[model samples]
Target: MKTKFFSLLVACLIVTSVFSQANLNDYKYVIVPTKYDFLKESNQYQLNALTQFLFNKYGFETLMEGDEYPEDLVRNRCLALRSNVTKDAGLFKTKLLITLKGCNDQVVFTSQLGESREKEYNKAYTEAIRNAFKSFEAVNYKYEPKAKDVMVATENTEVKNEVAKEIKKLKEEIQALKEEKKAEVIEVEETVVEVVKKAPVVKVQTKEVKNTKEKVDMKASTSVLYAQEIENGFQLVDSSPKVIYKIKKTSMKDVFLVISKNGTLSKKGSDWILEYYENDVLKQEVLNIKF
Candidate 1:
């Protein structure tokens, strides 16, 4: 009877473990911090990089903190788990443990304690982190977004399609207007030519040149902007600490609607580009933004 009960308990435990691992598949991304709490600076000894690599190797899509997130993840942060590493006090050895938390700050999973006896900080941390990742290897994480996430994605897709259709319709109307205006201008020019041909021609010559320079407005573009997080977005300030532009968050990732400038700020490659209309002319400026 005792043997049978023990076997049943073991089976229940195995089932529970499997269930927990399967739940992890609901998360689409693992966000690793650039710096661990135990370390002095960011990515010290390349430990964070190794952590990211290991997560990727175990079939988990990993991203470093502060990296531009996918639009879905930005809209619904709960789809991604935040990773943290903690170091335990050890006299003769280095020990590390990895913890993953949800967007609500709930602990989702914790790795087994990883230990190394190496004296060097780099080697010790690397070995300890790798050892701790054995748990992840066993689980073999693969992203399988939940039903709710899939529904949300579908809704977003529908909205984007509607918006695209409206934009296309507007473009077609503008093109038709331009064609009509071009035809009207040609007719007017032809009338002017007929009048000139019917009238006598007279030419006037002058040696003196008249000044035709027009006043132009110059904007300073050398000031570096500092981003300060606000309620829905951020306010950019210059070195003098004066607010330059207030940008609001958009549904798209790495794209913000500039409230102050009536423009859009978007990330293109490694640069942040600001585009707005000034004096009926569209202008694009590369912003030196420190976030």
Candidate 2:
């Protein structure tokens, strides 16, 4: 009888331990902000990037705050967990904690306190953050979204209803506009035909000129870049994934240039090179790019 009782006690304790350790797999994704509350600027000392890198290493899909939301998250924002790094001040030690919060702003899990005695801010913060992440390293992360969280489901339902109403209204408005446009087209058909015939030669020249100007403007506007993959070009961003430069591929093999921008970066026989106009003079620099 005592042996049976001991076995039962051990089973209960095992179950309790499993439940107490928050399973990160319950969350679909982790969102890391560009800046922590303790920092003034985005990616200051590259802490934000470090946080994102660690989360990604631990098998969690991460998204920056400025990034476009994935379809699943767009449909339900509560699907992802927001990551926060909080700092604890000590007289001779720097301490930090990594926390995950749900959409309702409730903290689901927090890492054990990480401490460092380094005098430098950057080194201390980096070491402390690394220590805190040790807690996450022990867990095997596998995505298992909590579909039955009642509060999250209710909030999502309310948002879905509102979006549905807005979409219906927009569709009705668009249908009305189409009908109005059709009537206008009929009224202007005869006039348009007469004008086309009279100004065919002049219109051809004007179109060529307009097309040239449009090409120039498009090239100029492409200078602004973001880390997000675009349809026709590539972008370079900082640790915060803020766009610093935009590059467009050229006809030459493995060569890319800044579209209408004052800089050009190209691969040159085992080395990457960058040339740009700065201070009304051309400047060149060697770049070390990882693929």
Candidate 3:
């Protein structure tokens, strides 16, 4: 009697897994939020970006929260699932889990708990997220939208065209804002130069900036570093998955303040260079960075 009961439990587990996989495969895309409720800032420690990256890596089509949605997804929200990462209280560990919900706000799937004991916030979050994603290894997800969604797509050609037009308009607006920001940066630089000329103390600071720029290496580094978005600006990481530098945005375009280091990170042509003072001499190292 005990053996028979064990067999029945195994059968039930298999059936539940199959059902969950079927529901997951019916959705074509997943949307990851720009920020998680447990975090104070958008993409803090690059957790949100890491979430999207892991989903795409695990055979799911993932989109950022504010990204333009496909026409069918816009028309029938049920065609996509919403993704969320939740934190669990732990005394000495960072614990997290991934949840996927349907259009009706019903939870469709939840990943196993992922925990990390790393003391650093960034490392802890990264490890916990990757651990949570391990649950998807067996899913083998491939979108097989239901027949009803396919039929709606076939019948909504006009609506698709309108969505396309709206997407185009959004792109134009984004470009305009970028250009406006560049203009403001240039104006700020001009004002700074005027102040330097009028004040003796300011003039000395201007010379320091000039010397830093002059020390920059024109040749770019052959090795590349990846830039991960953080709260203010970005953190550059090496291939070893180590943080090389954390930079904050400056008013000037393509220039960043290297935190804790008396230096600046700036773009020269297509290459990024780090200029810092070691002892009394200024040193420059060109960096190949991917954002």
Candidate 4:
């Protein structure tokens, strides 16, 4: 009886150790979101599917995923996470965080999920994450992301001046509208002109037409404001490589920022060369931003 109990205790210890030392990698390239994001958010199934497909191709299994209980509220997910974590919380956790492991505890990849803002992040977010991860082609497992150089600015005084003037105009228009709203008196006029009856009616008709046109213009102005505030529609470039390179800072003379497929910003320093591959094969390194 004693021997049997001792053996069982040893077995239990081994199992516990295995669970505790679980590798947190998902794959080589994509640092992925944990499964909880998929379970909690009913929508974004397409995002979930793409994530699974990428990791499954590389033999990644979903480890035990649950509420992460971050050290602080993890800034980004304070609302969902319920804490004061970070001001740029969206930078990290509003997105799902998936992990993949390989070869006895080596980290493969971790990917983030969700778009940055309230806007419904489209399939592009996932695609961006996937492509960012896919850029890593080393089979032996080196996951250093690189950044491209910031383009040199050319001298164009005229263009710069025009842009400055246009921006100023837009700002002034926005302010003028706001001021007009605060101080203007909206008067509804009614007057009976005793002179030449037809002439007075014509004047009244002309004023009514002008008011109608003004109403249409006001409605259009409100729509323009809504578009500017809500849909910003800023375009971004891929910067995972740039971000990684900056972090490494190996012989880097300048800095670059990159967006991983997971929609997070990364930094890269100088010594980075561009790499291209089609299915785990390197095509070439061009060494120039445009190339």
Best by lDDT: 3
Q: Please report, as a residue range, the 10-residue window in candidate 4 with the lowest summed lDDT.
A: 218-227
Off by over 4 Å in 4: 1-34, 59-88, 91-98, 101-119, 140-291
User: What value of lDDT does candidate 4 attain over all alpha carbons?
Assistant: 0.34
Which of candidates 1 and 4 is the stronger one according to lDDT? Answer: 1
- Scored against the true structure, residue 206 in model 2 reaches a CA lDDT of 52
The segments of candidate 1 whose C-alpha lies over 4 angstroms from its true place after superposition are: 1-13, 198-291
Q: How do the residues 78-104 of candidate 2 rate in per-residue lDDT, one tens digit apiece?
A: 779999999997999999999988888
Ranking by TM-score: 1, 3, 2, 4
Model 4, span 107-168: residue lDDT tens: 43343332333344564456454653352222223222112111211224456788999999
Clashing pairs in 1: none
lDDT of 2 at 39: 87
Best of the two (2, 4) by lDDT: 2
Please provide, for model 3 over 1-291, each residue's C-alpha lDDT reduced to its tens digit, 9 standing for 90 to 100. Answer: 999999999999788788889999999999999999999999999999999999999899999999999877887888889999999999999999999999999999999999999999999999999999998987888899778777777668767799999999999999999999999988876775464335333244357658765442334468789999997689999999999899877656887778867577888788787876665445677988999
lDDT of 2 at 250: 47
User: What would you estimate as the lDDT of candidate 3?
Assistant: 0.85
Summarize candidate 1's per-residue lDDT along 1-291 as a digit string, tens digits: 999999999999778668768878888899999998888999999999999999999988999999999999999999899999999999999999999998899888888999999999999999999999998766867788788888989999999999999999999999999999999977866764465344221111011111323232324367789999998789999989999999876655887778877767789898898876566444567888999
lDDT of 3 at 22: 95
TM-scores for every predicted model: 0.64, 0.46, 0.53, 0.21
Overall local distance difference test of candidate 1: 0.83
